[model samples]
Target: MKTARLCAGLMAVLVLTVSGCSAADQAQNPSPTSAAALTSCPATPLQAPAGNGQAPQGPPMNELKVPVDTSTSKVIDPAGAKQIQCGRTQLKTTDDVAYSTATLANGTAKPLHLDIQVPAGDSAKPLVVYVPGGGFSSANRKQTLNLRTFVAESGYVVASIEYRVQPDGATYADGLADIKAAVSYLRTNAATYGINPDKVALWGESAGGYLASMAGVTDTDPKSRVQAVIDKFGASDISKLMADYGPQIEQGFANSPNPIGQYITGSPAKSLAASPEAVTAANPVTHADAGDPPLLIFHGDNDRVISPSQTLLLHNAMTKAGATSTRYVVHGADHGDLAFIGDPNAVSPWSTEPVVSAMVDFLKATLS
Candidate 1:
């Protein structure tokens, strides 16, 4: 599982940092100050509305100089859609979109930050909040720069957010809270950022996909409910994952002294309380209902890390529950390899261009 891999990778980095250098060398080469210090958003109380399963109405959108065409086109050739347009100028960006000052369930007191990029247009545009995948243990905002740039150029306001990660003692629930908080913050300050709060979309991959799915299904106050969702190769159910990948998970634990091991094994009783299965049951599929916003899911058929079956499960549940949903299985691609967008070491059997095009088309149609 990605979590296990993340645990091992984190440990490796820690070891390399400590054992690979001598005391004098370490003193000479101090680590850079934590990025957490860069947070500049005022410490306002984090306010989240109660989940009500109602779609919130955003402020009316100003007429675009070039209105986006909302039409169904070949899914395989997303670029064929005339709605896809690049802004004439470079996107304007604002970093450190913060929401909190208090330390969350995650040990870190660092405020949550999101990097916002606005397209060149003056019209209030739909906002897309991007959550990057890092096995719930790390935030990979930098990794999604390419996709962020591409999306921003296509005329949407993009906010690549940093949420609490596992390494900071954050659980699935905690992460969701942070996501909801980000949504609240964006909507509360929508006009200031030229965003149309009502047309918000949540897009995430891998672990982030899982979080985005949860956000889509879970009820939220009108200000926080996203109008659309884009989930790429994220696990849909944790219990099912444990059942399907028990051996691999065991091997992952055996190979490293996972920093989260204590959190996983400290107490058999508490473990049951915090079991991934229990946590996952509260995932998107479980909450699937008629009120969920339209969803677009993409998964690699050959994904070994998180099975494509997970996507199938969620899609089926959403359909059965009468919620709008769509799924695309990229043949021969693996986890996070839905083309060439992630992890260079991973296999990418298909071209990423079409995949991104499809995403742009979906967002334009749903949020337009």
Candidate 2:
């Protein structure tokens, strides 16, 4: 069972000042500045309404208010679909469909959980594995107005996944393996869900983004192979993350679950498999060859959690590797705020029309 706990903002500073990326270079891609990169963003971004579809009619010009500063540590009972609110935004799937869940092998008695939304008819639709972010400690597959809904409506069988947290430290490797397992499961069960496995896409946010990007980059295992990747503020290099997210080094490291550390063991001379970052150079971007699938990244210029540079670096790397890539850096949107941080919605004039529109267009062009 999942629980919801109100998290008070941890005033942990995560800043990593890299020497190579200059101010001009930073402006273009803004390398991950200290993991806890804080930039004073506008209260409201250039808003836009929900894309063409049936959407809620909320107050016009809804300003995203930063939650009150208070310590609300009580673990409230998790509610149904009506209660979880990632943000005020909503994704418009093509039809009303039933959802189901299952478990996978994560070396635990408890099976890894997965919640999937199948398309309306028996017609095969592409399957997209959705990964949520929480610094590796919190969050679940809640049906918030988050990206899951968008992926669903965009003609894909959406699966909201749950991976083990870092409390035990094997979560990263288990999580990646779980993603691969999920893909295998989807491919094996495609007929039942009316999904097309060949067109699979991995969409992840924050830490989940890292998982999704890794899956996209590494296709050695047929079961874990993903045809496309949608990384929302995910990191490719753990060393880069360690360098950038300063004070909260332990926390960031914990977030990754250090699969590299667990997978490889030997003397310091055995440098081939010591740390994730060390091996990350062979990651999606590192091993980016002309044949790899395209990647679509969504990030905010003012993101304080994950630097916009992460997104930029990824986009540049993808393009350089002959992979198609599209990056959208919302001017005023912050990390985890791209969903509803801005005023753009069905009701407001300042809604996120351009961003949402571009996202849909990109998904269609690539995923479709």
Candidate 3:
């Protein structure tokens, strides 16, 4: 199952970073700190609406029932939850739409698709692209329908698009291409869907978070440029992985013959370690420009798959580069678990309420 693969591949990313990138010869795309990217952003960002979307307190199942932080957690979704419109116009979803197409490395044509949900009205709504994460190996556009429906209910047009995966030799660069293509498609056909092309944002989780972060920072092209970004527990810097998890990551690779590193980098294990070039290319921090859009980052303090330090690297880098960036560290939450909506186990009504609310708030603030 891709779920299992996503869960397992995330840990394997440490191995890939430890060994280095496959394309060691590529030149690093320098962060656009120059005068050209002068889109000044606010010094700070808005805080999450419900205090970082903390889980509700409950009695411990075993020794004692633990308490959820009621102040921070809001019950947006109740038991047997139905879609909530939040006192707005109703919404509708247009599923399985072919948004773009491209020729693959093997000369095969690949058609990309997206599922968009928007409020039913003539008014233009800001667009939010939902990028799924499966260690960049598996992508499920419908993974987080609750989040999508919730955002759409908040009067934003949300599109969940599929991108090329790492298993198919698609690197971060390729994935970004697919993402940009989707954005262009949406923008080109904005009126057809009643979309606000200028007000655009990207929201991604885990691997998708990484892509969104990259998309947030990359402004070389106007088609893919966005106004805001949301990264949920995605890794940012790979260069620091080796030092942070030296032995902790090595032992994880001992028994596994096919580690995720090779799959993502599109390189063999025996290949010489990648130089700083590949690392610079993959890390979103290296691409953070002064004109980068407002960014909201969330990471669990207890995330075992990708270290919290990873997100810290990105937030710090972007802040230093003159970008408006904010981060909320979720307490007692793990990667893509109870705190987020994409996971299958995230069925509890309150599980995603806080984060979804926070996300919608961020979008309203930035994309307005």
Which candidate number has the best TM-score?
A: 3
The order by descending lDDT is 3, 1, 2
Candidate 2 regions with alpha-carbon error over 4 angstroms: 1-107, 143-146, 242-284, 338-351
The residue-by-residue lDDT of candidate 1 on 61-163, one tens digit each, is 1111221111211123222221211223467889876765547553447788888988876799899999877666676554445456667778899898888
| Pairs clashing within candidate 3 | 56-68, 57-67, 57-68, 58-68, 59-65, 59-66, 60-64, 60-65, 60-66
lDDT of 2: 0.50
Model 3 spans with C-alpha error above 4 angstroms: 1-88, 241-246, 250-264, 270-275, 338-350
For model 2, residues 57-95, the per-residue Cα lDDT tens digits are 322111222321112111111111111112122232332
Give me the overall lDDT of model 1.
Answer: 0.61
Winner by lDDT between candidate 2 and candidate 1: 1
- Candidate 2's TM-score reads 0.60
Give the Cα lDDT of each candidate. Answer: 0.61, 0.50, 0.63
Error of 3 at 140 (Å): 1.0
- TM-score per model over all chains: 0.69, 0.60, 0.72
Query: By the TM-score metric, which is better: model 1 or model 3?
Result: 3
- Model 3: lDDT equals 0.63
